[model samples]
Target: MSAPPPADSPRLDLLRFLERVQLQDLQRTRDWIAAEEKHAVLEAARRPAPPPPEWLIEYGIGTGRPAARVHAGSCWDTRRR
Candidate 1:
């Protein structure tokens, strides 16, 4: 076997190298997260808010038994089986 590195020569070089690699990995991950956040913000700004529910606009004013109740009754009846 080859002689081991001298104890006085900072035998912890491997540990230091590993730590540097891990630090680089962490930095890359952080950069990716930042980029993703930026993309999400841009997408949100580009997309329009969804329009209000049709029922809300159509039934806003007084109407014969709100459409909801009518639909609910029919759904309940069908589920009785």
Candidate 2:
């Protein structure tokens, strides 16, 4: 084994090594996340999204109305008094 650096000497070799590893890991993680997003987008694109139901938009009333006046431009999930 080689002798350790003198106390006076700066220990930059470890820092450089760590920086390299950190950069590599960051890039790998970024690539992985990008791949996951692309896969999700592709899967979503492959499957046709169901069209919005006629009443789901026109009346916004499907489920039991908690309020008398259901707001327009909102889904049946949203209710307003």
Question: What would the TM-scores of all predictions be?
Answer: 0.55, 0.55
How far in Å is the alpha carbon of 11 misplaced in model 2? 2.1
- Predictions in order: lDDT: 0.65, 0.69
Model 1 scores a TM of 0.55
Could you tell me how far off, in angstroms, the CA of residue 40 lies in candidate 2 after the best superposition?
0.7
Model 1 lDDT per residue over 1-81, tens place? 988777655657877788999999999999999999999999999999986433321232355634332233224333211
Candidate 2: clashing pairs of residues: none
lDDT of 2: 0.69
Instruction: Give me the runs in candidate 2 sitting further than 4 Å from their true place.
Output: 1-10, 56-81
- Ten-residue segment with the worst summed lDDT in candidate 2? 52-61
Model 1 pairs whose backbones collide: none
For candidate 1, the per-residue lDDT at 38 reads 100
